[model samples]
Target: MRVPMILALVTVLAGCADSHRWSPQQNGSARITTSDRIFITTPADGEYGDNVYSGSGRNTAKIIYNAASAKSHLVRIGGLAENYQDAINQAQGAEQDILIFPTILHWEDRATEWSMISDKVEIKVEVIQVQTGAVISSGIIKGSSGLATLGGDHPQDLLPQPIAEFVSSLF
Candidate 1:
């Protein structure tokens, strides 16, 4: 009996330390901020101070966003899914020497002021050169949005919007 009780106590203590088990707190509105890095590597023979090569090295890019259990509805999945997917699709279709991979997702719960009803989320992205594995350009983007059930307006909506803005700005 003593051994069983001790095991139970230890299990409970370990579970409490798990961050994923914690729920997101509400302050006022939910917000998500995302950042991405875009890099374009020069061709290998382009002249690395000593050598001259043909073609480009390997153009690469990546995008990382804060990780969290987000409700599909809150992200405008049903309503604005087309728009969101279209943007990424177009980027993939663009003419570039490198290949494009799906955006990697990362999320974590954020603490908010009790008086406020909103929470914060963050997203980031990275682009890398395939051949040389070098990062040419990188950037960070962030947005804040509303909480669950109440998904009408969210500050994080700016996340995707900035993606387009940033990509264009890169050129």
Candidate 2:
């Protein structure tokens, strides 16, 4: 009887684990998306003289996602925009390079289990070089379909993929 009770407890715990998800470590080509011809900027590349908005003088980049897609997208963007700005501010102070204002939209891909498909307008971003007048970088943030199980419908952590990839590209 004790053995049966322990097995039942283990099963219950496993089920609970399935319901509460965690951010997955980025790995595999299918999970991570990268951009070519675009580069990440550093804080040393751009900076302002005590101006809160004054970022590195290099250039500026902005990200925009469709508001109509998922109800969660707005919340995701709000969180990511803050992170992006903070990254820009840090990059400016460190490298003095600023991404140009008015970003670019590469493409948006939706999350799916069997195959990765473009739907739901899940992720989109834009990047530009202000001085040079060039579209420096752009891409869609994406996550694995496996994330759909827990808090599925949409996973908030997947929102950071673009920022992470963009930073990686800069290096």
Candidate 3:
């Protein structure tokens, strides 16, 4: 009897553990040209359980890099840096065109079963001009991996889709 009740509660919570929805507000005047050289800044740390994932920032940057690299006009792609200023300094030193900053606003992972979990994440992206240090564009991207059965794929794998879509739309 107690086991059944516990199972029901787990199912309910699992169903409720949906991903975040982002309503991106864009700046109409912002423009990203095909000739721009791009640099992606590391994302901020995100909490998952008691430990914080510092790698989340770098991971998000990589996703953006991968998406942008496919474009022919993007001259060069910059790697992850410690923070926004660090990335800007590096981009400026390298004579890059634009610097991208990605921040993980919220990340949550809840265990649904012994082997399954639900993962949700929210990300904010900002584009800045490396030369003038002016913000060119800014938007929020959020998503989740709903009730994934853990084993074959990493839990946070699906989290990058929304970010990629948002970045792609900028160009």
RMSD of each: 18.8, 15.5, 5.4
lDDT of 1 by residue, 1-171 (tens): 999999988865653321111121211221222222221222111132343322211111211111111211111111111232343343334432221222212222223222234433233333333334344334444444323313333223334445454433323
Model 3 stretches astray by more than 4 angstroms: 1-20, 25-28, 73-82, 113-117, 148-155
Question: Please, what's the RMSD in Å of model 3?
Answer: 5.4
Once model 1 is optimally superposed onto the true structure by TM-score, how far is the C-alpha of residue 8 displaced, in angstroms?
54
Q: Against the true structure, what is each candidate's TM-score?
A: 0.31, 0.30, 0.71
On the 0 to 100 scale, the lDDT of residue 100 in model 3 is 80
Per-residue alpha-carbon lDDT of candidate 3 for residues 1-171, written as tens digits (9 for 90 to 100) = 999999999986775454655466655466678888887766666777786876766676777777777663564545556567777887898888888877777776555445345566777777888888878778776666556344333325655566666666777
Candidate 1 scores a C-alpha RMSD against the true structure in Å of 18.8
Superior candidate under TM-score, 1 versus 2: 1
User: In order, how many clashes per candidate?
Assistant: 52, 30, 1
Q: Give candidate 2 regions above 4 Å deviation.
A: 1-97, 100-121
Clash number for candidate 1: 52
What value of lDDT does candidate 1 attain over all alpha carbons? 0.29
Ten-residue stretch with the least lDDT total in model 1:
72-81
lDDT, candidates in the order shown: 0.29, 0.32, 0.68
Assess the local accuracy of residue 90 in candidate 1 as a C-alpha lDDT between 0 and 100: 37
Model 1 segments more than 4 A misplaced: 1-96, 99-115, 146-150, 154-156
Native-to-model Cα distance after best TM-score fit, residue 47 in candidate 2, in Å:
34
